[model samples]
Target: MKRAQHFIGVAVAAAAVIGVTSLVGNDYYLRIIFMMCVYYLCAAGMNVLVGFAGQKSLGQAGLFAAGAYAVALLTTKTEISPWLALIAAAAISGVCGVLIALPSLRVKGPYLAMVTLAFGIVVEKLVGEWTEVFGGAQGIYGIRPITWNDQPLTSQQWVWFAVVLCALAHLLLRNLLQGRFGRALLSLQADEIASASVGVRVYRAKVIAFVVAAVTCGIAGALVAQQNQYINSDFITFHLSIFILLLVLFGGAGSMYGPLIGAVILTAVDAALARWPSAQHFLYGFLLLFALYVMPGGVAGVFRALFKERTETEAGEKSEEPPKTTRIGPAGEGELLAVEGVTKAYGGVKPAQNVSFRLQRGHIHALIGPNGAGKSTMINMLTGVVKPTSGSIRFLGQEIAGKPAHLICSMGMGRTFQNLRLFSDLSVLDNVMLGRHTRMRNGFFSSLMGLPVAGRQEAVTRGRALELLELVGLAHLAHQPAGSLPYGLQRRAELARALATEPQLLLLDEPAAGLNPHETAELGQQLLRIGRCGVSILMVEHHMDLVMSVSDHVIVLDYGIKIAEGKPAEVQCNPRVIEAYLGVDDEDDIEARETCPPSEGRRDAET
Candidate 1:
């Protein structure tokens, strides 16, 4: 349904373009339109990397220059067909993108920006210095125009060709963004840590985004070369790179139509200001500032905000439903997770040392100690986010100590963070959808081609995600952004997301840390319900009441070593457990507690 809507929208847009082109037949107007399309294509390509993939690259000008020169050199010197040279230009630019991305991957933020900026300068200089092929700073001229079937194409025809290519590029990019790779890029942009935890290969995704962006830019470069029948280093300058970046930002980075809107507006302004040279620069700068101040989210963002508000208003009229309670089955009896001789040290400080424990399936097992007890460290090791110095972790009989977090998750181990690693920018449903990503077996091509299997998989995943949200009492907030939810609700949503992976073993780190007593009690009940549903839970919690109520077994750790382990009742009375909690023991009080009735004794011991 969404695909059909997008196609219809594109068709309408194409018709509008045709109408505008036919009505405005002036050569200057035609040229401006053609330039606008080319600019849009370039800006859209950059958006894929900076907006979606979350990588900053200022080297697009270098890739664009490479593509232009490739076409110029091939057509002028090698007698290669212009069409064939265009393909070669895209391929060469893509290779350059890979080369640039390989090193840029190791650097990020301002450093990456500097590296790519340097790349652009280097390419420009190289083109000027290598005069033999490039025709020096004057550039190559008299480049043969593209022709079809031995017929010379007119200027208007070339303009139409550029427009069609631009439209195709826009459609292709929109489709790519709607697919798996697009989701992965958006996921990375939203939260790299959470993305990696869910098994997104961050480096690989960034490189692919870079290459895809370069390829699109290369195509745009070829069109420009064909349109002009001449090329020069000035056409692909550092300023052009900055201009494209600004276009992307002004259009709204992630929106498909942002680049088109930005390009048309900026290009028209530039063309209009051409006669007034004195004020052109200042006027353009002032306009850019105004746009930045008035529409920071850009044109696309304005529409998105309006759409979101309308959606919320409509949803507000729906009947409210009570929170759905989880229906967990009986806790499994066998061991679900095992850590043997696991040790980890950081700069000689032992965070976890020889930690060994077995967690029973379907049980809420708590690992508690003071601030430095390695409780969190142990959890990290088990989840594959951190590697143990020496030890092995097994989940359901398979070793998973040093594997990537995503692989561990794929093996049915799901975890929530103490600091809240939810994708705050995504809606509640989208957040949970990310957890179900591994279950999606369809590839990028499969989604683009809209194969039957991919369609079924997408539908199943969406339904399952909705069900998981319902299970956690968050279905009502499905459309709400994760960051906007109340803290307690956000935590619940995180739990729902983890469960969406359908893990056999769930690791929750402090699910009730900041909740009020009422909320804590509700959380305890939820944990018990989850345990009943056949998910073995390993929890690190400071709330003794919540832990004692839900946990079937408890393991005590002190200064990176296990102090004691037993059933909740047995471990509560152990001398070391008392010392770990209270620091000092009262012998008379211990005896008094031991003498009390079992239920009363447990309550007294808890206090």
Candidate 2:
């Protein structure tokens, strides 16, 4: 059904372009189409970074200007061919993007946004101040028009060419979004910690996203310069950057068609309103408000809502199945994880001090401690999210103490966070598919072209994700938005996502935290089942009942120091454990005393 819908949509888009081009040869409409194509390319690129990769960049127009100016200067002043200039423009912009992204990667949220905005301002100022090179405020003029051979191309012909190019780029982006790189980006966006734990290089993915967006914006800028035949710094101003961002948001950030829809609607409205003069700005603001309030998910989300109507109506008819649990059979004796004197300190506070533990193959090891006892810190150190101050961690006989999270994950160690970190906006199925990124071997070209190997790998990964979801009892919610699931179910989905990485050792942090008594019991059963599947489990849990029942070995920590280690019952009776919980005097009293005061003493006290 989805494939059929895609085919129909493509056919409709092709027919519309052809019909509109043939019937509307007027200069005004042709210009509108050209603007749409330019915006489409820019927004699509922005979406790759912001939507798919989950990085907020506000310097898109700066990059666009860089590309346009590069092309304009090269073609007009340097006597370079227009085609060569376009290529050079894209290359230059791509390089600038990498530079900008390098600094921005160190910051996140508003900081990153501010930095990118500053970059745009800097670029604009540079263009305005460099009079000899950039023509200052007057900008460059008399730009030679593009031509095929000796004959100049008509405006209609340019529009047609742009339409074809933009369409092809869109198709390529759509394929990229469905492949391994796309999955890795989504994974990083969803949960960077979990993504790294599953072998995704978070920084590399962010860089790729930024570069891809910049390259696309560069192409769009070149096209715009050619279309206008007069290039200026004003063409890629701060307002243009904001406008492109607005388009992405107003059209739905993650959807493939969002930017195109947003570009067409906003541009058409703006163009029509321009004729009104007095009421134009006011009308445009009103329409924007209306769109924001009425369709917050943007135009693409509106279409999705309509498409899912029938599926939502028939949701009650879906099948029911038992929740799947991780289960591994016994394996030959081999060490899965070995941590030797792992120590981590934050400023002056020690969270993990000389914590040493070893996990064997097919065993469920429990690390239990009170709040702030360094349990989570130890897990972070093991997974490379936090570097240990001292000590070494060996997984499968290889030292991985200071390795990055993604590298650690690629080595077959997967972990979940204490808090639920599922990608709220992505569907459950996509969330699981992200876990398979480390195992996928296809590159950007293979994915964009939909090579045979890429297709087969994608199919296998999808099936694996589905199976893992079934194991975690979220198969029924595969198509549902992950954020919409109930808390317990979301936790289960997190586990499913981790298992999708096919890790040899799984680290579960507080997996049973929010579950009820019955749910905790079920989770305990699931942990044992996972151990039976040959996947060594290291669980950090506060639920004593679940931990005691499921753990093959229990290690207790108090104030960053290991006080007791043994079977669950044995550790529960340790004097140090009792002292940590109920104090030393209370432990002695519990061992020495049996009953309370007598009735006579009570009567005398009453008197």
How many steric clashes between backbone atoms does each model show? 4, 10
Q: How close is candidate 2 to the true structure, as a TM-score?
A: 0.90
Score candidate 1 by lDDT: 0.79
- Strongest candidate by lDDT: 1
Judged by whole-model lDDT over C-alpha atoms, candidate 2 comes out at: 0.79
* Per-residue lDDT over 33-122 for candidate 1, one digit per residue giving the tens place of the 0 to 100 score: 888888887898898998888788888899888888888888888888888988999999999889888875578877988888898999
lDDT of each: 0.79, 0.79
- Against the hidden reference, what TM-scores do the models get? 0.91, 0.90
Best by TM-score: 1
In candidate 2, what are the lDDT values of residues 96-215, reduced to their tens digit? Answer: 899888975579878888889999999988888888988877888866667898665688878877887787787778778877888788877777776777777888888889988899
Off by over 4 Å in 2: 1-12, 275-294, 310-331, 586-607
